[model samples]
Target: MQIVFVGGSTGQGGSPRLYRDELSGDFIVQGYLVTDPSDLAQMKIPDGESVVRVPRSLFDYLPKDDADGVA
Candidate 1:
């Protein structure tokens, strides 16, 4: 699936980056749970159904429009 980095900064170094699937529009971080967007070079397409540890703070940086039910 095609992935796009929705927000956040790649320069943060070890800071986790958010990625969105261009096809499914599903947000993913560290692989498992669908979450948000990323930098191209440093990103890896998530595989399998195993959940990985992700930084909760990354959610705050996602675009408000991407939320499931804010309206």
Candidate 2:
């Protein structure tokens, strides 16, 4: 499956980025793992699925329209 870079928040390490699956048009997010007990308890996380935390600023880089012709 082909993947394309979407956007990322500015930082020293430059993490917390978004990516798109070229074939499926599904989004893949890269961010810090949410392992806090209290936070984890609030959500019904299924097996094989983990939560990730990302800064609100990351959404600012998301495209308003279909930019990569994936839609």
Candidate 3:
């Protein structure tokens, strides 16, 4: 269940954060449109496919080195 912050869009209002699951290779986005994993349940994604949402605070959990890279 290890999650890693990936990247996000720099759109007008605010940028949404993106995350990736190291174990499942799933992508999670926080902000706008899709706000929760259950939001995609109706999309009928593949059996194991996952597109979820996590707290913005998750960004603070990134490794120090990774955080430096983003800056």
The Cα local distance difference test for each model comes to 0.59, 0.81, 0.60
Better of 1 and 2 by lDDT: 2
Best-first order by lDDT:
2, 3, 1
Q: What stretches of model 3 exceed 4 Å from their correct place?
A: 9-15, 33-71
Model 2 residue runs over 4 Å out of place are: 11-14, 66-71
Candidate 1 Cα errors over 4 Å, as ranges = 8-15, 31-48, 66-71
Comparing 1 with 2 on TM-score, the higher-scoring candidate is 2
Model 2, range 1-71, lDDT digits (tens) per residue? Answer: 68888888665546798888888877888899999999999999999999999999887766776776444
User: Residue by residue across 1-71, what tens digits does model 1's lDDT show?
Assistant: 99876555445544467778877767767423534443323556556533455667777766686366121
Tell me the lDDT of model 3 at 35.
40
Error of 2 at 6 (Å): 1.2
Top-scoring candidate (TM-score): 2
Candidate 1 vs candidate 3: which has greater TM-score? 1
Worst 10 residues of 2 by lDDT: 62-71
User: How many residue pairs clash in model 1?
Assistant: 8
